[model samples]
Target: MTDTERLRRWRLVLGGDDDGTGATLTGDDARMDAALYKLYGSRPGGRGGRRGAGLGDSAPSVARWLGDVRTYFPTPVVRVMQRDAIERLDLTRLLLEPEMLDAVEPDVHLVGTLLSLHRLLPDRARESARAVVARVVADLERRLAQRTRSALGGALDRTARTPRPRRPAEIDWGATIRANLRHYLPEHNTVIPERLVAYGRRQQAIKRDVILAVDQSGSMAASLVYASVFGAVLASLRSLRTSLVVFDTSVVDLTPDLHDPVELLFGARLGGGTDINRAVAYCASLVDRPDDTILVLVSDLYEGGVRDELLQRIARLTASGVTVIALLALSDEGTPAYDTENAAALAALGVPAFACTPDRFPDLMAAAIEHRDLTPFTNHNT
Candidate 1:
């Protein structure tokens, strides 16, 4: 790009007049600058440090700032600014205002903030708050639900597929073609089948049991929001007996509300000291068939309860043939702060401890079900 263009971009980045770019913003750019200044003006370590900040306590002013940000920024950038506004300005009261909620761009972080404030929400603002949350949930389910179902369904079908079909009706033709694709004879226009993929003679009643144990600490807000949505999706799969358990210092079984993630999210009490052992013990008690169960512990492994007991319980779970994995995080935040010692011990016990993105989660679950190598999803390549 030209030097003039570069200076203009840098001028926007460093909002100060004496930022050394000698670039001046006008019209729309000026309005954008004003919107950003209100939020970040007094934030430390910026181009101009700690001058003035916040849009003030007026409802219209906050709502106007929200609208200005949306107009000036893309949806992703708008969401980030909204998140920052809440954190930097302590704008929990903005969420309680219907106009502020209506003007705001809803995202996962926003949903998480709303869920955290679910208890204190006023009766008048609750519907609008829920509508914002529901919109985000619908969007996530639209993007993720089909992919999750498809991946898990394929994995489960493969798990139950037989190599030899007794009759033509029992053969899975599409699967057979896929299995023999590499052995196809182009000259004959046919596949040379080395082994056939077929449907099992009898289907198992319950294919697998999935238990999602989530940590609901204040820092784990985003993870809980994503987990709640996934819990609902997992619950919808009839063959998998899915259970949703949320914990802080105490454990609350939200399996009954798993059908509606919004309700399940409302059930969560977010900010407290973590007790991984107590939560794990409660979830383990619900596991009737260990051999057929996949227990996913979504936590940072900060043990407030007995550490040795938690590790021992996990070891016993893995020993009894239950698949156990500890997700240090399950959000776009990448690797969060977790107890390295606990993670290392869990890894030593043949369980994978890693952070997974929401998009990669379905594949992660599929691999766990089919017993596939999980290294790709872990992103631990050094």
Candidate 2:
């Protein structure tokens, strides 16, 4: 690599520390250094000596620092730095302030923090928090909405196919040809289909019920954001009944807010003890047809509720033909901190438990809707 590239990498690694590395930053690099220093540099003490620095006590100073990071770095890098500030400087409580809320860039992690702090936020700051959550929700919707809709819609269409056709319009030519490809005659060089496959007529009634039972513990903030967005997308389909239920110790049904993910997210209460069995029982009550329901539980499986009851409930759901899935997390942060015992117990009951990224979720849902083996998707991601 070039010397400039090496310097940039070392600058990022060293952060705001000046350890006599014999490297000098100029131009844009110098500006980057200034931004980093604002967040991580040491400050001069009142007695004219050096003191440990931080985000400072002033809200506006932190706000301006937020803006400087955004201006100096790309969106992804800004998100990482913002997350680091929250951790290193203990800035999560400050996020409840309206001015602080306005200054920071919106992302899944930020939304997670806001949701966790929702109950403690003052009335005046609640609106600002909602706005920040809304911005992140809108961005995720723009990026994932179309892909999710297309994947699930295709799955629904595929599942609607039948072997018997009443008219030519209903025939699935591609499926028919593939099903009979082994019957090709060498002389004629053409395949003859002994049976026909046809698309079922569009149903005016609901065909499937999707229940997203999300764990809202403080660690599950990212999963909550992704689940809310997906709930909204699934609810938009005419042939599916979608419901979103968020739980910590208590369960709150946010299905009513599925049309607006922002509102759904705001309705959630993050950070509390988890009760997987209680939440699963509540989700079970929503299932009118166990054979046609998809229950996706997004949690780390750190069950604070009854353990035996949770395992039994999952066993019952699977026995009743309910397609139950346990997602350890739903972000790109890779394998999350999860309870391996609970995960393995669920696996023993014939339910696949794994961590899925946001990009793979649509495909996972489609696979579940079609009752296909989830090992391919799960194994690949895990």
Clashing pairs in 1: none
User: In order, what lDDT does every prediction score?
Assistant: 0.87, 0.87
- TM-scores, all candidates, are 0.92, 0.91
Task: Give candidate 2's error at residue 238 in angstroms.
Answer: 1.7
Q: Against the true structure, what is every candidate's RMSD?
A: 2.8, 3.2
Best candidate according to TM-score: 1
**What digit string (tens of lDDT, one per residue) describes model 2 on residues 1-382?**
9977777668654753454355777887787777776555653532123256566776687898888788889999999989988887788778878899989989999888888888899998999988888888899999998999999888888888888888888898899999998997989988898988886746557778999999999999999999999899999998789999999988989999999898788888888799999999999899879989999999999999999999998899989999999999988888899999999999999888999999999999999998889999878977
lDDT for predicted candidate 2 compared with the true structure: 0.87
* Model 2 TM-score, all chains together: 0.91
